[model samples]
Target: MTDHIGTAPVRDGLHGGGRRRELAAATVGSVVESFDWNLYAVLAPYFAADLFGHGKGGVNGVLAAYATFAVGFVARPVGSYLIGRLSDTRGRRLALSLGMAVIAVASLGLAALPGQRSIGVWAAVLAVVVRVVQGLAFGGEAPSVAAYVTETAPPRHRFAFSSVSYGGIILGSLLSFGVLTALIRTLGKSGLENGGWRWGFLVAALLGLGAVWVRRAAPESEEFHRARARQRPGGRPPFLRTLREHRRSVFTVFLNTLGGTVGYYFALTYLPQYAAAYHVIDKETAASFMTVVLAVVLVTMLLTGAAADRFGLLPVARIGFWLPVPAVPVLLAGLRGGWLSFQLVAVLLGMLVATVLGTLNVFTGLLFPTEVRAVGLGVVNAATIAAFGGSFPLLAEWLGDHHRLGLIPFYVTVCTAGPAVGLLTAMRVPSFAAAVQEAEAGIQRTPGSA
Candidate 1:
């Protein structure tokens, strides 16, 4: 069940408390990455009019902003593939650092850009370009962090430890929400609407630099070093050949992520996007509810991680995948005329999604040997996210506009259950499951494992 090309297990060269340091570096990258990416979503409503349409924050402006958001997703696959190759070739530390720097540049560009009123159509053009750059940079962020962080874990606690990276995501979301909420109180909605949102972008840019600085001091994973050592002059085959050998594993990653990606994006964006486009919820209330959900989800993620560590990844992840099916219908039902109850529904959905996010790296990280783990997760996960998660808001909005809102639940249901189906299918494929199981065993035997 090991790598067909004769790979050795990854034995790290750690001394002292290197594992904690690596986790911190990866966690910071996750925070900055989440801050930079989610900033656009959190503040898009306030800034959409200024940068997007005819100086009015209406449906069209929101649509235009979301379109730019989707455009950013388009660049993700390319970014992940390139960064995956870079990480596999150079080092995870280098790749993670590079992505953070790119995000910083994009954040600064967004912070300083002129709005449509000031620069006309060129403002829109610049926004799109900046988002695309940001998306491409962010494409590398997750896989690199996942590979770096999870590889440092003991096999026994890998799931719980994996939560650290995603917990960073929730913390970053909280930071974005907290920052914007403070600005709203200080400057008022009128101020944010009048261009105060730019400050958030500036802060995000600064944070990105901080993440890069932290990453610079972090050590590279010993697992990566072992993989590199295995690649003697004549030892490894062509990269494509290596990929072909593990194509089924890559496909498993894709299926596993299909619904998981969409569910995460949908849970995070739906209420806000709906609030923006239709005005069903006010900005402040939306922010407050999201903050609450994020806090709950953060704690829930850590607990789920611990659960997976105890019950096994597949079992815990199954709960995440299936819970969304029954929950989405109720959530969509609440959206119809029950504003007071929507917060409860949203929290439920958020917790379900967090379960997936929390244990995801364990599945992806162990699906391949150390040599291709980053790229194996990177390319497939990015492609699935871009295709489903990126395009979701536009699709949902279009459906709502057409009065076909009833269909939305069906989509969400299917996506939430996709991973379960994928896992079931993979169980029948001896090679794919065996590969993951094989890596799982090796991880337990890793340097720091209990």
Candidate 2:
């Protein structure tokens, strides 16, 4: 099962076309899930005035809108716990289907909900509620899908396969950017304010439904089935078991994700807003640039994953996390000046961020065994993403408003530094990949007795 790339052997019972189908289902579902989740952020500025009203209060209104977006992150950890437990107890296919169903309903809800003019603050309230639902669903969806892909992939190809989920995310963002750019050109600002933003959400809802249908036929991960069968009846819940037994893995993942999530949000999600807010670029231009940046990221992500398979995960991950440390400051310096310089530096930084995230999902999945894999990743990812990823834009906006724009790059540098240090330190201990292989071997040996 081992390959020339030095990846562990592929697990039995999942090979050939069967594995490809599972990866396809998982990738499509991820794309749809991310599309639904990111639609609001992509269209936020266009819809802000409608949802929160206009005037000087408009600035506060946009912030409020972003705050509502962050509210979804607040619900992620809860979703992670509940859904992760469900995935461990039930099955990956069921958990994924249910998560996609929630995303579909939530996206459609956002699409159909009344605006502030029609319902006053209630409009914002309802939006927040829908975001929470989406957040919860995503909390479960991301980790479960990552685990499923890793478990089912040919061992040598796990990194590449796991990158598919990240690819879906980038593709989703690219789709959002394309839709937004098209809407801007066709609708203009007024039309977008009138009702055009809803189209994005509506489209996401449809795609989510399509993803659910596709996922319904996906085969359950063989590894999950084997792991579940190996668990003793009435044993402790997976979450608790994970906390007690895999504390180091959980902590390591948290530190690693803190950097990756922060870098991702800072570099990709908030870049357009940052450019617009600081007058570095117009909104339209920023969106166009972001579309290009996302395309670059998508390519870099896949390449980094492939590299991880050939080289070692630690070395690849180290390069990803460390490169951004020096690059962030240089990019920020460029942003303070000419547009051409800013765009060049920004693209370079975007690629660096993509490199980190490209390998991160697979690396995180390798940190835990099948028994606690889903919950372990869900909790750690949910926690970091909520705390760092969710707050990134808000924090950047706040800093910009206060004339502390200089602090932004430093913030990004600190975030990246922590994970770089953690990765280097962890490399000295039991390797995460080896630990994962050992755990899998143990499961194969004792089919009904963990």
Candidate 3:
């Protein structure tokens, strides 16, 4: 059968060696992006006193650092618009390379920055600036990589390939926590606070540079090349056209993302900080727990992705969404009890969230056509994550201060419900992926096409 004008020909289940090379590059690029973005979370406790000057250095100091962490996400939406547009207009390979370059620079800046003792508040200011740049880079990196992986994979294996993108994030978290655990074991608390944390940022910088080189050598996706070739001489910007034509798709993707974002941040990323703040566990213990949680999540994610390929995206997504609603309250109750319970429940929660993330990348990629897929996914992802995911740490901190910590599980439950409902509504539309494919075909057949 002949291929569609702007689409690559579908292949069998097995991928060629060249396609495998593209996957490896995208995976490494994603790992570097995740490491750069999340490294601050692991080190925040040690640096909070020096950077933010929170009195006697307790929960308040950690909260201040987390606040700075949250501020970084504020730039994500703007970055998504600018960099996602670049991917649409230029090429995925260029966007991936450029984002990694920015990440490397920002990671190096963080490693070299002086504390408040040297530059006073400027140290904090500089930290936030580097974080913003990192956020911007990540905003571009995720969608382009996801789109590239999805568009390049064979129809029978798209979910399996796309799932590897999220696996990079799990591995990045594991690496960050593993290094922190080892540092605490070797250097002890005071030593880490004094200077040891900088090494982690330095490692991230080196990894980011390596990923930039890898992505630079990777080939551009055939789908992107075909779509670019068919662009009209003068037309509306892809972002604007996406808004005008694909509003429902954009909204569906946003709703689909809400549950996974809230669950992952609250359950995995912020849990360590919360444990340290409440004195439920030492920093080293928290790091150890997260290391284990990440290992479980990585395995679960790969399995869930394969399940999506075998069963269906919507079925896997629905299971992921609803299972967590009841499980969260029970886990939170366990968390309030003690450290052992916290570790066990946290691992279970991570696995549940991984199932959602497993299929989400492919589901969102199929929502838009090749021409606007990157920007559409990026804009929706950045907005929802900034609004809900990034703010969860700060919000939980405030709630804990107000003696309302028990409400967090209920908040997560509500967020999970949105995706379950949104996805069911989305499936009601007949052949949603087919509709996107047909739209791309229509664009290719437009009059005066190249």
Candidate 4:
């Protein structure tokens, strides 16, 4: 509620308790938004064919819907550039509020959309369009939240605070699995496809309003205010210029991001579908396992955050880096074996991957300076997410249908290795620290530097 737009306020409550509180508020809002966005993926298989199908091949139509699901990731970089620019020039708070508003509206719109029986192909088109809007909002959300947390928290706790941004993700997963479990219990199978899915979206729409309340309570970050106060000449760096100069940092981030995306999507997004397809688990059982796994994921997320604080980002990232190399193969083996063992192994794999991703929330937040943090996070995340996260489901679906299911672990291994190598190399680079210093320097030299 207090505005310190043109000057750095005295390091009083706002810089201390007030700032952390506001950052926490922002993180809470982000978690709610993520819950809304991700809830759809869990329910996608049920709704996609039912509503989006062309009345042709039922399951095939559903598969097409999943493919369309990947299309949203394509817009992430575009959204990152557009939204990230707006956040930098305008303000992180404004950018986030606008993004959340857009997502809220999109969720409500999707809730109201007509199904295939009612509108035919247009329904599918409408769904895709709304999803693209959601993707755009998401593209901005992660970076904006990460930047806000890092800037607002005390320097010593930067990694700890930033981890909260991804904690929101785990929170979302928890809410999603919990909500779906309850819905399935009440609605039963037919109710699920016929009316339950729509209600699920409605639940997301309602949760979105919580973001508005949280953002309202959020106080802006000191770093942003500081940058604005300096008001120095020629302080702004073109996005591309920043990238060109810090090419290695950017690559490291991309790779770091890649590892998280592949591991996460493979475990969270594709696993349920894979389990159901192979009859390894029934729909309800799969949902239950997912819910339980997510609970474990939530716990690991917090531990990883604390770990980052105690140990630092590099070491934590390294653990995440190599832990999954062996874990991936074991994960697939469990899935292929049987339902009971697969569920147990699935949870274990989820925990391992969760640790890797949990580490990322802090490290990636620290990667860029406040000036372009949103976009930097956005670009790297967008690229890696699009390449790995978005394509994961579709690829898994294809591989499964073609009887190439054995390749799943190999695919995960390849993707996981990309970021592992990138991060390890980045640890050795001289410019990693310099990059952060340069970014901060640019901000201090900017107009009205705080």
| Candidate 1 accuracy as lDDT | 0.77
lDDT of 3 by residue, 189-234 (tens): 8988987888889999999888888887788888887777887876
Worst 10 residues of 1 by lDDT: 4-13
lDDT of 1 by residue, 36-88 (tens): 87788778778988998653444577678878888898999889878988997
What do the candidate models score in CA lDDT, each in turn?
0.77, 0.77, 0.78, 0.71
Runs with alpha carbons beyond 4 Å of true place in candidate 4: 1-17, 54-59, 231-234, 338-340, 428-431, 434-450
Candidate that scores best on lDDT: 3
TM-score of each predicted structure versus truth: 0.89, 0.91, 0.91, 0.88
User: Ranking by lDDT, best first?
Assistant: 3, 2, 1, 4
- Report how far residue 329 has shifted in candidate 3, in Å: 1.4
Cα error of candidate 2 at position 134, Å: 0.9
Q: What is the per-residue lDDT of model 2 for residues 1-450, given as tens digits with 9 covering 90 to 100?
A: 222112334453325677767888889987886677667887887788777766364367778778878889989999988898888789889999999999999999988999988998888788888899889999999888877776776665667776767789888888888888888889987899898999999999999999999898888877776677777988646467667766767777887888878877777777777777667778678777788888888999999877766564656776787888887877777786654454776688779878877766667776667767788789889988999888877788788778887788788889877678767545543546554454346545655331
Model 2 residue pairs with clashes: none
Q: List, residue by residue over 311-367, the lDDT tens digit for candidate 4.
A: 555567677778888877866776777634657777887787777766565456555
